[model samples]
Target: MAVPLLGEHLLFTLRSPRLPTHAGQVSFPGGVVEPGEGVVEAALREAEEEVGLKGVEPLGFLSPTYSPQGFLVQPVVVFREDLPPLKPNPEEVAEILLAPLGELLEVEPWSEVRLGRIVWHFPWRGVDIWGVTGNILKAFLEVWREGKSPPHELL
Candidate 1:
């Protein structure tokens, strides 16, 4: 799912740099749910903490994707009716970038470099947005383009 922005769709980015797992990578601001938090709550909470976005109205839950690093990440889709200007916490996020989803949907503009059996490349900037997060986005975009949900395996 995507959010409407100025007659187009917009997606937020988390600029994570100098880390162990996904250092110097650009990603959506989310992580695994904590002990007591549900997927919806965790998604909203993480978005707010990682990037100071407020009043996010969660539309519904999407397919949960599995991370190779052992995270079962539920993609909770949301819409920001009155979103506050973002202020990313440097400890967790270095920068926040907004991209038009319509632009991202144009697959012709992206190159898919195959790494392994399941590791195909979708390059954006110097960072490779691959693996679980990239898979989720790929599925999401397929759904958007085809007007039907792809057969997603549960994580």
Candidate 2:
């Protein structure tokens, strides 16, 4: 997954409502890694394909995230000096959402119990960013708060 930083904000996507699965949900730009591809390479490729994001530099890797669907997601952190005009692929993405990193850190997260384990939600623009995406964001924020992990350049 590509957890992209456009300056001081993070980028997320609202999946198209027409999609069969995970439709209308918020997520990072990602997909299953292709055969022979490295995790970071797959993340960069997926970001470009789903969101028309190009030329962003990969900063580093975050810890692997586990999903309810039984697969581990290897997350790659990426950065851009300035956000470019983003074009969402209509078949997969509905809208692109940007959240300032500081704002996300300040908002408290609500939790759910149905997933057998606690799952969290961070509200933004009236949509709940929950499930794996939320988990990923939560982890990233924790690391950022510790003044480590994302590399000094992000600070």
Candidate 3:
């Protein structure tokens, strides 16, 4: 999920060292949906739990992406006029990062063929956002830049 903060910045989280997978990696605040929870509900709940973010309006959902680790992720876009003070959960989140959207857009994506497939990486500061997160951001920027939906097949 993407959280648009005040000043057009995007919110991200650094996973805690205690995480089983992707530990210490940078990602948007989100997790698996529970049996009775919807995508938006799961996204919001995770956001609040991981970063103490609240009172955001749901903009829309991006295309679902399948992770290499065997999970489907739905990127939910949300907006807030301003962000509240954050208290990151130590167990799930190590730190909260607010990155400017324009700066992120300007960074060139690093790509290479790995295991017979192309993988893209976006390095922001010291965080390397790759895998599913990078793909989602690429798709979001593509739509934002073109001002139209991406190819349905691409989604």
- List the candidates' TM-scores in order: 0.75, 0.92, 0.87
- Name the best candidate (by TM-score): 2
Candidate models: Cα lDDT each: 0.60, 0.87, 0.77
Tell me the tens digit of each residue's lDDT in model 3 across 62-134: 8887665657788988777666788999999999989887888898998765554455789989789877777
lDDT of 3 at 1: 58
CA error at residue 112 for candidate 1, angstroms = 8.2
Candidate order by TM-score, highest to lowest? Answer: 2, 3, 1
Best prediction by lDDT = 2
Off by over 4 Å in 3: 2-6, 113-118, 148-155
Answer with 1 or 3, whichever has the higher lDDT: 3
- Report clashes for each candidate as comma-separated counts: 0, 0, 0
Ranking by lDDT: 2, 3, 1
Tens digits of per-residue lDDT for model 2 on 44-116?
Answer: 9999999999889888877887876656888899998788889999999999998988889888998886447
Better of 1 and 2 by lDDT: 2
Which stretches in model 1 have alpha-carbon errors above 4 Å? 1-7, 81-83, 108-117, 125-127, 148-155
